[model samples]
Target chain A: MKGKTIIKRYPALLIQGGRTQKVEDWVAVEGSYELYLNDTLVDTIVVSPTDLEAHALGYLVTEGFLKPEEVTGVEQQGDQIFVRTATKKIIPRKAAHQNVIYRRREWGEIPVVSSTLEVSPALIIQCAQQIPEHSESWKKTGGIHCSVLFDQEGRVIKAAEDIGRWNTVDKIVGYALLHRIPLTKKILGCSGRQPEGMVLKAARAQIPIVVTKAAVIDRGIEVAERLGVTLIGFAREDRFTIYAHPERVRVAFSPHLR
Target chain B: MKGKTIIKRYPALLIQGGRTQKVEDWVAVEGSYELYLNDTLVDTIVVSPTDLEAHALGYLVTEGFLKPEEVTGVEQQGDQIFVRTATKKIIPRKAAHQNVIYRRREWGEIPVVSSTLEVSPALIIQCAQQIPEHSESWKKTGGIHCSVLFDQEGRVIKAAEDIGRWNTVDKIVGYALLHRIPLTKKILGCSGRQPEGMVLKAARAQIPIVVTKAAVIDRGIEVAERLGVTLIGFAREDRFTIYAHPERVRVAFSPHLR
Candidate 1:
């Protein structure tokens, strides 16, 4: 049987004083592609052609499929990507299993590391307050995911919008990688649930602090605790709970900044 | 400078239908497990441990890092996952070129052969209308993604919700895999953008029909066109655009279904 396909545009809908209006729209096209290596199918990915090469490389590395040095050249002709490997025989073994093993043997068994920063109720409140204002797409389409990068001062630095939560994080990571931004210094603030994958992405980027206004799954907490990455969730006004790595968030003795 | 971590949960205030409610939210959890190949480190993935083995296997296959038969055994202890491979040497050489190669090669190329199915505008409207009613979490927290599976009659069979769009689809796919459900006769209705990843997932599952109420990107269209999958987008009450395989969507001349 065959599959079906459709195309549509995203219009910036504005609601002012209960009146809804279309501001602008952009034509968005979508499709799937299967990736091949040396005439053998490797994997499949979904993305835009605008930055196909970078996406391929980043996805492979992040997923532990390929290393940087092993690739001699990457060429794209039409829709097919040919990756030249320095090794004559690419190991038929899958890299994803290796990643799982590495996580278990090295970092998985480590005791949950304690953080130094002490989070305050006020900080969580402040972060939650910032979400509604920043989520322009949500207000427009009632669809879309958002990832925001913030400094220690709780100010937004870079915000990315996507249809998927993981994709938004990946885009931010990709953006950070392109600009040579120091990821460790930033806190990842997202409007999506903090799952294991979300924490993993932050960990891969070496981001220490992850804050969200949504619920955190158990696996996400477990990963964060193991990675020494602080995981915080349920950001609202004047109240919060610490899951793991509580030391990094400094709680003010008084309401005023010291 | 050493990275800092902050973990916390917050009380959230929800605003729906001009009503305000408060809930305790826990977002981030630390979960870490490593996989080992004969005491060697290969890769790592952060995901919910509920289906660690399946996730590991699926990850390996989807990432093009390992084949199913190449894996000998998969064991999960607590939060850690260990996957043993038959091959002794496994090295990933494409780590550095991850993003670039993936995007360019996959997105730029369209499939050569594909199948398409035609859907009625009324059915599309019904699917769109049903989405909001099925989204419980979104109605509560306004933060979640949904994927619904429907039979040819446009009756929804199952609906899955998740913090990540991919996860929702993965859960549905995993469910189908477990139940031995054939996807060739169903339509995948999503509340997210039709990306190459989403389309590839449907293709991998051999699903024949994909319908979305959101915008479609260029690559998504290309993939559906090539895979012979019917792609439909902007599935609203009165209108939709078909990108490929239009022959399958049988339209009746009469307004009534006979």
Candidate 2:
């Protein structure tokens, strides 16, 4: 690990129990990073200072701007990232920006996920609970969101943390792609709420199962249902709710149901 | 109050304590909205379906795309919002998109807030605690983020909620602008993390104080300090952390210190 700086000390007044004290607080670091794809300024992201390459790659892959295998090289300077892809085609500038808030209808039909990966409820619960343990920056600053990737056998492949919830998901996606970890049979665990953007990221990346320790919005359910992705929300303390494609999760049969 | 549909019922599987049952769950609604300023397509937003007008106005104001007073009329047709501003000048197409993830360095100098408003910690704590009460959508779906605007005397001016965190802040800003509520002496309470982009919104809108029930990152503090905005974080249960400009919050003198 490069151990990029993710937290900084700041002065703060802590008020508690009718008393106030000045103290040095640990705060998560956030900065604007310029991302260049094939020598073109594609976009800028205000994200945690670390994991610039992963952020760039993940953003490109999940946004349909570029596929993971298409990338030829990646280089990061002070606050700018330059990525060289194998293709010589120029991406429409309008499409690059518009895709940030992409409308499902305008984007045409999204390919439905066809992964047949199956995992037990216990495995998902374990992954969701393990999110906090893998988040070092979050432990230090209490301001970061984390996402973890697990292989088919419930083994951790990699994890990422960012000040932005969506960035964490992109970081993990970028990490998996950079390390050549196949996403088809993996489970994604996030420490943020499940929204349409997040669920769509998993669907686009072909990650069949997504579990979160937070709530899932209506569009998240709709997108997950339409794209054939399994979404689990409110996954904590050994319980969870499956909003879509619950068949991917194996639930034990109980005689009380009869 | 114009009530747009903010929640929808969805089918889900509730799993708890070694049991799983099929149930209907209430989820917060999210949709894609097109925003046109002066007959020019500006941007698209993925936000909650309710409060479309406020969302459009707030987004334009906080993003530095248009001044609130410059807006002559606003119309909502289903999923699209048409905003007619008084100014005839066309907004640069590139500026509209690039500003979404703006780099402070590239945006030139930001106006420093000069408000001298002061309030007691009790008022802020009250405002922070009131966030949950004003969040009707949150109580129903548990997926929405709420932003509340309070006047100098701690009276609630308006509150708004959305599936996206930043949209809540923009909605309230738009609400204040629509109703001609001055933001100079107002306090904004948010139910989401404080980041640089969020702090910049308060600064650009001239809201002097910002309090949140969530954590504040380092860039949020940097922006608040530079822009002369009072920033508070982790404001819950009568305790709060003042991340920047602590002087705006008056602390009562206690003899125990002597």
Candidate 3:
């Protein structure tokens, strides 16, 4: 459980109804943590400050840096994560400063999401309602973005909440990899906008259905459609928009009927 | 305008009332844009894909990469942003991947925000209502984050909308720097969570007040208090929670009176 990685209390003035009242409320704490590969700085993340090992591992795995078992061990300092893999490689100076934004035309060629799991609307709404309950930080600060990996029966596999939506997804992925929780047939649910990066991460994991309580961006829809991953957005208690394969969701989504 | 960086249309399947419907809607287009510093890769960003110059300038300035003026010119190709700074320095390998997460212990040493502008609650509420009108992408995809720099009389100085909240702030900051828009005594309003990173960006610019339609995390409050900036969160049509510096707001946010 990567819950309440950091939370601090502060007195706030709630000005409403023409009245001012002071109340103590919990606020999400964000800290910057550095990740080092072979003692060379690779990345820095500002998060709710929980799950450093998992974050480092997941980030490495997703960024194509390292495989799960390839890493011998991970060490952590105050705000730094050190991952020692089997081979130590110094990142090329030119590549080190490469801040890149990329989209591949061939990403949709082969979709790994071949799960036959049937996720009903009830199941999605049930999970969307339960997403906030899994995070103490979100309840306290209303400031966290949460991601939960759930089994077919609504059992939460691994849950992670972070101020950065990407970190939350990374935490979940790391938890799954470390615990060996299968992702292929699982449902990934989150409370943040689904951009292409988020969709790409889930698609890479072959997560069948990605559900959210927020809006789905245009690229998110494209990636999901191309990757054969089902993307459900604005997943309120009763309604949801499926951008990709709805047949796999046990619902007949008729785009032509409209 | 950075408006419609990319908008793609796709047929979507809708499920509600135990019914199936198909519809066509506008989806946000996200692409990976490689940022270059004199033909050297600096960073990559996946965004809905508008406002390359603003995004490049804003990202450079906020990330402490370079001052806006240091950038001599900007060139864009399909999905690449090439920033030509005063000098093409090969960032030392060590400094290349230097990911920094910074928190200042003494951010309130001297309040950069000494503006006497008394913002009425009505003004904040009015701006909150007006923020939605600024972004066409948000309306279409329901997937964009928008920010506005508003004046004392409720005139919007610069407004930006992006898939990344950070990028949205950078766009606004870049607009200000490019157009020489005055930030002091102005209000910066956004539609995302007020985390420390966002707050620090505003504080660094000496913006007196920062408001959001979302919640403020604890780190955001601390940063605002220490940086002599007023932070207003959970701002809705008629109400908002003032986390730090309420006197600057016309409403009596008396933290000491309690």
Highest lDDT model number: 2
Candidate 1 has an fnat equal to: 0.01
DockQ of each: 0.03, 0.04, 0.04
Q: Which order, best to worst by TM-score?
A: 2, 3, 1
Name the regions of candidate 2 deviating beyond 4 angstroms: A1-109, A252-258, B1-108, B252-258
lDDT of each: 0.52, 0.64, 0.60
Clash counts for the predictions, in order: 108, 0, 18
Give the lowest summed-lDDT range of ten residues in model 3 chain B. Answer: B96-105
TM-score for the B chain of model 1 = 0.54
Q: TM-score each candidate.
A: 0.48, 0.60, 0.58
Model number with the top DockQ: 3
Task: Give the CAPRI class of candidate 3.
Answer: incorrect
Residue B154 displacement (Å), model 1: 1.5
For model 2, residues B114-222, the per-residue Cα lDDT tens digits are 8889997788878988998986556755666678889888888887655545656655764564355777889999998766667877776778999989876555676
Best by TM-score: 2
* lDDT (10s digit) by residue, model 3, range B1-258: 234434333332222222323434332233345667777776564332344554454444433355444667777776677778677744332332212112122344434556777777778777777787886556655666688889888888767655556546655654564355667878888988765657766776667888888876556666777777778776776566666776666543233311
